[model samples]
Target chain A: MPATSGHAARPEASGPTGEPFLEVDRASVQYGSTKVLSELSLGVMRGEFVALLGSSGCGKTTLLRTIAGFMMPTSGSIRVGGRDVTRQPPDRRGMALVFQSYALWPHMTVARNIGYGLKLRGKPRQEIAARVAEMQALLGLEGLGERKPAELSGGQRQRVALGRALAISPDILLLDEPLSNLDARIRLTVRHEISALQKRLGITAIHVTHDREEAMVMADRIVILNAGRIAQIGTPQEVYNRPSSSFVAAFMGAENVVPLLVEAGGERLRIAAGPVNRAAAIPAEGRRLGGRVVEARFRSEAAELHSATAFPKEKATEDALVLDGVVMQASYPGGVWRHVVKIGEATIVVDSSHAFASGEAVSVKVPAEALFLFDATDCKEGEEELR
Target chain B: MSVLAETAAPARAAAWYWIPRAVLFGLLAFIIFGPLVNLLLWTVTEKWYFPHALPLEYGFSYWGRVFSPRGNAMGSLGTSALVACLTVFLSLLLAIPAGYALARLRLPFRSLILLALLVPNAFPNLPIYVNIARLFYQIGLNGTILGVVLVHTTHGLVYAVWIATAAFGAIEPELEEAARSSGASAFRAFRDVMLPLAAPGLMASAIFVFLESLDEFTGTFFVGAPDVTTLPLLLYTSAAGGNYQIASITALILLVPSIAFMFVVERFLRADVLANIGR
Candidate 1:
């Protein structure tokens, strides 16, 4: 395992040994006939930070709530420290959840809000006060302890919520998009603050979010959930660089997908490019591509666009793919110019440093390493039908 | 030209604003304050003949008489307070849980249940109280303070449930879930987080229940009369007997609780606090 300074050691590389700190085995949750989570399993080490990344209604929040014991799974079991806690309620599960809305007690002052859990546990008044003060200082809410939640700014209220969650000293910390409510500028700073705090405490944390950058920066392992199922789970760099499926590839900022026919030879895979595709031969690399059609995906920034008149006739590399297209639209989105290129019946957006006219013919060059290929039969439900 | 028009806008707007403002103020005073002034004057007046623009004479003798034991006003006042307080307690006990379920749970036939809660207030008071009085007689609860309180609570429950449902519905369930995740039990979460955050709405509903119970007359008359006399019943009997002074004094006594309740809950009635919960 690599020991990084402000981040946890990579959980995937650590490998499985003894029982994990938290184990969710084949958990499935259903709400009246609609299944929210289906046969999901995950294991988190003692001090690892894992992120569940997905779009809305993908069951990331459902999984978080189930792990926190707020929602009971219809089947399967959850174990914490080798003890089955499937039937236990949230209060007895030894975990704290920070809500996206902050969920601060609007009627109580900051000190009282942070001290509520201690008070419920019957801690001595002086001890509660001391712990509350410590949390306030840790979250940089020193002099504002007497102010109510309504008196604080959005960022300050978020800190108070974090302070309240941390003051309890739970075994696991659950955060459900806690920074989503903050403005973009505040979100960046708070993101670092929470990451630094989680590292400092070394508490096992599971953060659920839809923000790809947030997950990449804060989590030791990222679990991409699609339609209540795990699409892929790996280290941030691994998932970003090597997505396991077409859905995972599309989810990881590789939205442009092109279909191609592949014929597997002795050592190389011959790609039969279409009318707008460039023929290329690449090493099989152990990928199972038995299906005739393959879906090739790449990020918009990965493809370099140049005018067709200056394009070279021969291939630059054995793995590189070049495709012919015409610019359908072009616009500048801040730093770079983005062009929508029409190739055959499909359109893909590519980013360029220089501006190109809408009617100009161009060739898009995609490096081999930057491209991801998956069996077209494995395309997610409703996706291939649309194409 | 646009800049000049913008600069001159305030002067023209001010000239016409005062006219509408004065008319609104006058209408409000006439609609709300006129009856209150008349009621106050009738309470203090010793003698005021018909066609008199103002009372011919005024004194505190009626106020003194109402407080004396012979007047039986104080006893009725105590009865009204007891019934109203009990009604508030019982109504809240029933409404809070019902409201929570209605707002947060997926109960079957939810709209039907909500519509059923509104049935009590839809009908005339005479028919409802008569039926309740008959039911109380069969149960041997007629002419009892508990019976009167139960009757008042039935009326109060309808509005209480409606108001409480909206109140609890306005609160995000995430707030309570957060508490539960923080090592607090369900009851603790309700007590520490939900109750406080929903305090303003809950108090407003409770005040409405208290006031409704205090002002209820027909139910008290049918179910509690001849043995248990409440303030509203006393005021009705006094007015029916042509004792206008006593009726006025009884009305004033009933108004005191409503005023005190408003004062007690004024601080918690802040819109900012309620609107900003768990923001």
Candidate 2:
């Protein structure tokens, strides 16, 4: 394999691979009087693929552009390859960006688009031709080099954009939602192709995307951003399974969050779960009193529903927490059945193996570990409380 | 669907609205074209006045008299074309960059510059003509073709900048940003991405400025009286001199280019770009 062929060479250079290839320390960006990003710090290791995942206006794209040197941070610094490059221009910083719009020069052919950066850097004609040819072959664009961007398909235009960024062989590659313009199916295909290509090239990449699944699948680490601030940073599973905050938990597909009152009892904190579910145990460093239950939401797949008469068995796993309710609605979701069961005044959604009719009595067995608990006092459910 | 079918009666009635529209169009066409035909007839006739719609006599002697060896018909045509070309070139060179900067750049006090350009267009033309003639005389550009070209450029600059600025403003900044991120520099971005997209608008502004330079009478008459005789200036002078045939011939010369300019401009006017200027 080509991977093994390259891996056989002795590691070159003295710089430590452990040291961060790019560091954004306490970066704050402002557009006139409005502050877009505030005191955000992030680190990327050599050959690491990090995604700044957030919705629009969350400063994810702003952070990516700042790191590319298109935007100057009002405070703090950016160091790439151990060199302070905060005030450098985009072209001088040796970083290439693949814009969300696939900002290909419509007037130029695929080969010209791919070799534009090299031309700007003053590469000779033959060398540029060879490098462009290499990029075209690598991107599966061998015969389409003569076509303009307007002549190519959406996926092909994106590949040309990627090829252009990669042709420069910059220290880092920045992608600003490059897959956003593609159709959903094409987005998935191109995203996977981009991930494979980035890994093959062994280049550090910072991708900004609002698509949670895209971030989880493509990034080695996902940094969830909320309103211009870093809310959480972890591996895909780590962030999904053990989100430190309710925001991160919800962002990582834990769409269900219920308010809980914590009462400290030795090492295990008893969570007086909410109206819809029974109490559960969670480990916490208790420092506050119990608060009112405000909200409870959980993933539809995480909860289980069964006939109410079938009481909890003595050996229900510690991961399963139970609640009593009646099936308000049920649906067959291919593999498993989904039931929206109502318990008292609250409706708890759950998934079950067997189908149940509406108005049938049921119990929603929510795993204790799967339940995300947040104190009502700190739960505004808006950005103000999250910060 | 039933409601639409019931309303279809009024819609069918509305199709007859074109009857009045056709009549109005005919009236407007006759009002604009009638005097032009009468002027042509009078140019060839010996005696014609308000009551006579057509002439009894006609001859090519009017053209012979107007373009006689002693006449300055060719000289004035040469001057008019030269000044018009100069004005178009100078206005484009000055207006294109200023328009692009105003439209594309987020520069400080851009609205103030726009207001300054608009101020010249707001004032009456005679005051500007008098002031410009005095200024030119003071600067030793009194009766030269260069002086007239300068005055036409001044007048043309306002409308040129206003129209071209609007055209440049209508373009999507995303187009330029897309080019730059794909590795084109600021200059290349403008040349490749912006210029092609804005070609129709540039041509429209060019045609308007060319027509204005060809037909400016007051500025030339005040500053370029005897020495500079542009088409409009000579046409006005011959009319004031009581030689209606010469004046009609010169008017035809002036009218042809103006109509041709409008036709050319109409060919290049892209509804997509021009419609966005107001927005």
Return the top candidate by lDDT: 1
Measured with C-alpha atoms, the lDDT of residue A231 in candidate 1 is: 82
Best by TM-score: 1
**DockQ for candidate 1, C-alpha atoms:** 0.66
lDDT of 2 at B62: 75
Off by over 4 Å in 1: A1-18, A307-317, A328-337, A352-358, A378-387, B1-36, B50-55, B134-140, B259-279
What's the TM-score of each model vs. the native?
Answer: 0.87, 0.86
Query: Which 10 consecutive positions of candidate 1 chain A have the poorest summed lDDT?
Result: A1-10
lDDT of each residue in B1-279, candidate 1, tens digit only: 999999789878887888899999999999998988888999999999889999899998999999998888999989888999999999999999987778778889877888887778888989889999999999999999899989888889977777677777787788888788878888888878777767677788799899999999888999999898989899988999998899988998889888988786676455643453222
Q: Interface RMSD value for candidate 1, one decimal? A: 1.1
What's the CA error at residue A361 for candidate 2, in Å?
2.8
| Alpha-carbon local distance difference test for all models | 0.85, 0.77
lDDT of 1 by residue, A312-354 (tens): 6555336877888999999998889999999777899999999
Clashes of each: 0, 7
